[model samples]
Target: MAPWLQLLLLLGLLPGAAPAPNEPRAAGAQAWELASPELLEPARFALEMYNRGRAARTRAALRVVRGRVRRAGRGSLYSLKATLVEPPCNDPTVCQLPVSKKTLLCSFEVLNELGKHMLLRRDCGPVDTKITDDKSETFSSFLPLLNKDPLSQDFSVKMASIFKDFVTTYNRTYDTKEARWRMSVFANNMVRAQKIQALDRGTARYGVTKFSDLTEEEFRTIYLNPLLKEEPGKKMRLAQSIPDLPPPEWDWRSKGAVTKVKDQGMCGSCWAFSVTGNVEGQWFLKRGALLSLSEQELLDCDKVDKACLGGLPSSAYSAIRTLGGLETEDDYSYRGHLQTCSFSAVKAKVYINDSVELSQNEQKLAAWLAKKGPISVAINAFGMQFYRHGISHPLRPLCSPWLIDHAVLLVGYGNRSATPFWAIKNSWGTDWGEEGYYYLHRGSGACGVNIMASSAVVD
Candidate 1:
């Protein structure tokens, strides 16, 4: 026998040292009582290389057994008996053992110790050993690894069901690259959602249903492109200096100053939505009546601004003012495409005298919002593509303040659990965010919310 093989037999890791297959089993013996003989060659090679100080070769041999153990699952550990020549005891002098029978240590414990030793010795690179643990314990502990709290089995089932529903809901065809991409995105977003929820930052909870499958480009093209234009050289009018007593909390939705959330679909028409939303709030505040204005009017008639290709809310306001006025949604419905001007001064329902740009200071912005109605503003919406809610101020380095690319309606502000937030209404329909709204971390200039704050002057 090879010297390494003899050493393995002494350690009781080989089946040759165990009783014959026909021998009576001991009471409470596990099902995998016999280790497979195939494991001995690699084990002996690994030990031999380790003793020889060939770290690389030792790692290679250990990897072979590790792969087998992983493939065999944790249940196979019971069959792997390790003979401990030096038994673990509080007092070595008090320990006694029969000279004929070797002491068998728990295989799972021995394997774990071996893995730790290999890691400490740099024989193997760092690895998540928990992934190879007992299946039951592994699955139970998987959530924590992802920085999520333990989820109920029903929640897990529901998450799986949501993934299936997303495929059908988005009308995605299965088995294609796009389908596979969507699945990957959905799974990633689910994990992200759970991690966000675990943060307990606010009362909001994130989910993987709505915009999870859409790529950043797709999201920007559909919802954010309208605000992608360079800042126009025209100077914005300034509002009269108002008192600085901001309200404790305010929501235009509660006061009926905000309109129902509208979807831009595949059109880059958020510019029109933002303008119309601001006008809606202004009109409601001035006339004490709500009006659902036409976004299609802007798309068709606003030649100064691009319809679906993308435009700015400031430009949309300019187009509306240039066309003399804007019509109601019932008169000129949203087609989500560019068309020729169908402007009619006779059918115009509302008109803004002018629009004023607010200061970039968040405190001043908040004060203005408390006194005024909803404001049309542009923001850096990079991380907002999969935003599941919870004062969305991403800590990612890529979310720069200079990347302002999306236009939305700043409707209100409030603090939840002492965390202040800006209530902004998006144009991606009522199914997104807190019913078609997102709360941004207030007073931090989060996502460039303080960059381009502006409101229309309704008379």
Candidate 2:
């Protein structure tokens, strides 16, 4: 017989070879085996070395073990009693071999060398298994990393449901162990944030969805970049004297000065939303009817702005002033992308006479919001990305007063627990942050709320 035929017969691949009626099969012989000798030979040799406690002597031997184990599938390997060596080493650099679970013997040095070599491999299946096992051992380990408190069963179930919904809604794909682990971390953070909110310290805030999953860079790019634009050559004064008496607690949403919350999607066109919101409020106050003005108009027609890349509310105001006005959402509609200008002045429903920049004094801002309508403001919204609800006075370290990176509307102000806060409206839709509104620390220039504040005077 040919060597290939002999090998196939040995692997039980040729068929027709059956045991006698009275005879029995080998104790652990598998019905199915790998057809490739190239893979099987190395795997058998590696297993022999592992049994002899010499598997960690070389990198090549370790690679063979990992490859065969992965190719055979994790279930098959586990069934064979292939598990991590006992008494894990303290050092991270040391490797642990998957020895037969029944075997009690272990060699630390061999395991260490094997681990080091395994770490170097691009596709180390054993490392993947380790990560999987670690993830399974802890129910969302990232939760404890954020907060040491034990989570309730209800919270866990809710979080799991939320995670499932998020993955389904976003069409998220976790193709690898690392990806799944990351999703788990995000889910854990979401659950923790919810728990923090449930305590109702009244100061702790929580977000609606898994905003924690987004990195700072991703958040900045998607939600906070709209305010990044070159400033006008002439600096505008930001402070002006106002009455000493505190403004009344006000909410423009109640007064019908604010429109329904809008979403910018992935576009960095928050400048457009801010501009339109301010204009919408001004239009409502002047015309006695609320109108959803076109953010798409500015996104498409504003030559001075960078559309989705970034822009400024002030620049958007300038575009509106030049173009003679903006159309209604029903006419132009928001596409959430850069497109050719489809704006028509004939369809214009609102026009801005001019835009005025406000003083940096929080008191003055509060007064202006009370006296006027919604005003657009640029702010450092780094922490607002995860904001759910509450007085969002983010820690100083999480945000900087000088780094103004987002445009939002100042709708109202009030005192909560003797801590005054600015009622700011966001463009991330009604699902986020207090129905698209957030409260920030009123004074001390929190998150640059008092800086670069402006409002359009509409006709």
- Ten-residue segment with the worst summed lDDT in candidate 1? 113-122
Cα lDDT for residue 70, model 1? 32
lDDT of 1: 0.61
lDDT (Cα) of model 2: 0.61
Record all residue pairs in model 2 with backbone atoms less than 3 Å apart, i.e. clashing. 95-115, 206-388, 238-359, 238-360, 239-359
Q: Provide the TM-score for each candidate, comma-separated.
A: 0.61, 0.62
Candidate 1 residue pairs that clash: none
- List runs of model 2 lying over 4 Å from the truth: 1-162, 165-181, 184-202, 226-246
Find the number of clashing residue pairs for candidate 1.
0
Q: For candidate 2, lDDT tens digit of each residue in 185-292?
A: 666556545443443323846754546665433455556663353454123334344565555688888999988889998667888898899999998889998998
lDDT per model vs. reference: 0.61, 0.61
